[model samples]
Target chain A: MSKAERKAEVVDLKDRAAARQERLPVLKTYKLFIDGKFPRSESERYYALTSANGESIANVQLGSRKDFRNAVVAARKAFPGWAGRTAYNRGQILYRMAEMLEGRRAQFIEELETLGASRSEAETETAMAVDRLIYYAGWADKFQQVFSSVNPVASSHFNFSMLEPTGVAALLAPEDSGLLGLISVVAPAVAGGNSVVVLASHSKPLAAITFSEVLHTSDLPAGVINILTGTRKELLKHFASHMDVNALVYCGSDAEEIRTVQLEAAENLKRVVIEENSDWQSEERQSPYTILATQEVKTTWHPIGL
Target chain B: MPRNNAALAVTLPPQFVPIDEVGIDERVSRFSKRSIKKSSKVQALKLALSMLDLTTLSAHDTPERVRQLCHKAKNLLETMPELPHVGAVCVYGPLVKVAKEVLKGTKIHIAAVSTAFPSGMAPLKTKLIETRQFVADGADEIDMVISRGKFFEGDYDYVADEIAAVKEACGKAHLKVILETGELNTLDNVRRASDIAMHAGADFIKTSTGKVQPAATPQVTLVMLEAIRDFYYATGKKIGMKPAGGIATAKQALHYLVMLRETLGEAWLTPDLFRFGASKLANDILMQLVKEQTGAYQSIDYFSME
Candidate 1:
């Protein structure tokens, strides 16, 4: 046969094969993000996620206390480096994370919709989440100046109060709006220079786990934000009690759980910030105060110069 | 065993075979993939806890810090008094007195890493003096480093003599010969060193000085454990194995335990025969045990930092 006819025959065979079978859609395995790496929960236990129709979407890792402990270890290890970075550098890294989130915006929207969000709601939430990251990025360098003050004293000493990152913070993301709530809690803590162990909203975790991808690729140092997909009730007590965690931010309104958090946190005197039913899209939620909530104030006294 | 002149002349047994690189890599990958979950996992973690040689070998380690470590070794899980304590507290010779004082009236033994420690570069006389000083200060075990430079120089006799001398200096205190396997760079050399240390009267054959990279890798550890098994077959003596350093997580500790159990059977399961020379493993295991009982994820923050 002529060369052209041979090519036609090859194309015919390829078309026949394509017609016979199409590749299946790839489903991601959502694992816990600890330190800079992806790890299945050491418990090896998994809870399945379903759509509105109850069809299984994926298996999200059931992060146990061991997983949280490992994440805390990672967060603590990353804290020194993250907290020590120049404010400008941290801002750039946070901005880079925003950029990554923007790039993967469509995937996040799709994930939200798959978990029962309307298209418009998903789109708006995803946009808000990206904007929230950028908001925090800007605050990374400016929050210290906004919160710090030089105090007037009677003595010969010049006293000044400056905000410092709380080292390692435990974050329980709001059980509502995946994209907005996770980013709102995480963005500020990271902006203020604290590393965090964020338990993504169990009912709405896809966006959070997907956000870990944004973090993984961004210039933000590893372990700055460890995102876990698990129940807050089971993990919160350990989160509150862990001695290494300098602060814990809980974003739900459960009275018993709050009491447990308070009681457990007292063991190590960890700072507890409760955000009960707070709307992430509200003006109140977009302030530098959220960042300060995860920070500790250091007052230094300097001798007055002649 | 005395430092016998005739035993020093005895050649290494033929079972000190060359390590198969591909085979070892494959076997280790398999070990890394195996998961022991639930109650069995908790039991394994607790066993691993009992096998820990809680180490603080930094040059900056103070008596206060060592004392704190000894306290941690004894009260590994103070909140849960039923939890088992660590096998021993490992420290430098100078800190042995403080560690012993803190560990007084406790079942936890104090292990001192002598023989010039991480660098084994000091004169043999100085190492001997240090060993005796540690023993005098009430160190129950002596973890001695072999001169790697001499071993790499093919001075097997010198290496054997050095280990023997340190073992003699250890006297009633058990002697653990650290091969610093990272520096050895070859599994064959590690196997040979294991044999030499065993023959030279090391009560325990240890993997690293916690100051070296590539410490207690599964492949290297397996080779040493095999040497131990062979030594047991020949002399009917159970020489302990300590895979010290870089083993921080509970999962890694249990992996070591599983390797030990499958390789040497239940005889080596106890802390007396198979120990983990690890600084962070105790807390990690404690976290796991708490997670098991409480159904909550733990944080190092609530756990003891030391």
Candidate 2:
């Protein structure tokens, strides 16, 4: 064969290999995280997510009320077990979550950037999320000690107060910093020994779902932290009105939404804590009060000799 | 004894209508997919509430537990005084008297689980005495388990004769024959057992003893429902169906009702012709009904734990 013909054959083989590599990339399907498993919406509905430049990013699950109900059931099922664990074990698990997130730091940063955060903002948010988990982990074993009290009653009886987990918590993560916002809300509730069903930031949900992957592998029990990706406007009422939720944490300042939550939460008198328009990255956002928000105070009186 | 004509001679090589497993699965799937919405959902929940046989057949059943169950059966929810009483309170033979004293003057029937209960391994003479004693102790219904071992040994006639004898001992009490379809193994066997039970004078044919896995599944319920329909057509006797065990959700109870409505044409929708031998299912139905009334999901914590 001629040299020209051999060179042409080599070029053709390279072109074939390039074409094979250029086949459509396999995309990740963002699904609802319930009971530590990734499940698509039971309603079989999906919503398209887009970047700031109007470029389609991905199709994310549009969770239904039924999904919310199922998540609550799982959360309630996990509550007793999660709450019954020693605070030290829970703290260890939370620290393990931070370790998992740190191991996958690059992946989360890339995910946040793809969802439209700038590089610096994505890096800051990812770092804060890991630190926030560690912060709550430390509080898991100390909050009760700080909040519980030995009361001195006038009557001849021994009285004392102790903090207990407020059972299932329903949280609506802030719409701004998806990663840090979700971590801030979830860490406190779980560290206090309460299971949670959280609705992630509607626009930037990619990081929140990826964070669930961290929790899934970090020894966090299934259903202790269920994260769902969906629009807040659609799920706000269900999050507020579900009777099984003993506490609710909503991060926004919309008066109408707050009113709806307060009014509907009265159906079962769910303890609600609203953080309005606060910057999530501030040092003040990492307070132990966040953990106390979902803890119930139980006062016991013991009969004693006068 | 209200003996059926088919009981006169037990047919050897008994004729059982073969169940189309695929067809049954398809039909059951459709029933579950049905949209029972708005006012219809409320009505269905209420109907299901009335059809429940609140059962407590544990080996550790105490008189106090039976009494508590009877109270729950009579007054489902004190807060919701508008709800109807459960159809029956099902207990062990000895506990029937305890349940009867609590449910006396109420329309709720007391059903006793007899014939060695979950195992059904006792002698026929002992079973007869147990049934008669339960009836004399004010049990309005007797749920008897068929000898599954005899059925598996191909002794169809012994199974038939045993059921007839139990029915005679029942006297004025309604007789519900439990086939324990989970042990029967196949849909064909479930159908054959349903036919044998119906022909031997079962006022209601039940699916389980609540002690086995894979109990009262949609496929088994469907096969039994079809058998009941065919028997109605041939002998003009409308038999009842009770799919006990594992039917713990209101959605599942509604699906069974849908299957019953479609297969038997609404004639067997009444409590007299249908029953649910369930304990947890009552709370679920109450939760759904309360959710319908108040527009919020409910918690098991708020309901009685019978």
Best by lDDT: 2
Candidate 1 Cα lDDT to native? 0.87
Q: Model 1 chain A — which ten-residue stretch has the worst lDDT?
A: A19-28
Per-residue error for B97 in candidate 1, Å, reads: 5.8
Candidate 2, pairs of clashing residues: none
Choose the strongest candidate by TM-score.
2
lDDT by residue (tens digit), candidate 1, A80-99: 99999999999999899989
The 0-to-1 C-alpha lDDT of every candidate, in the order given, reads 0.87, 0.91
Model 2 misplaced regions, further than 4 Å: A1-9, A21-23, A154-156, A304-306, B1-16
**B-chain TM-score of model 1:** 0.94
In angstroms, give how far residue B131 of model 2 lies from its true place: 1.3
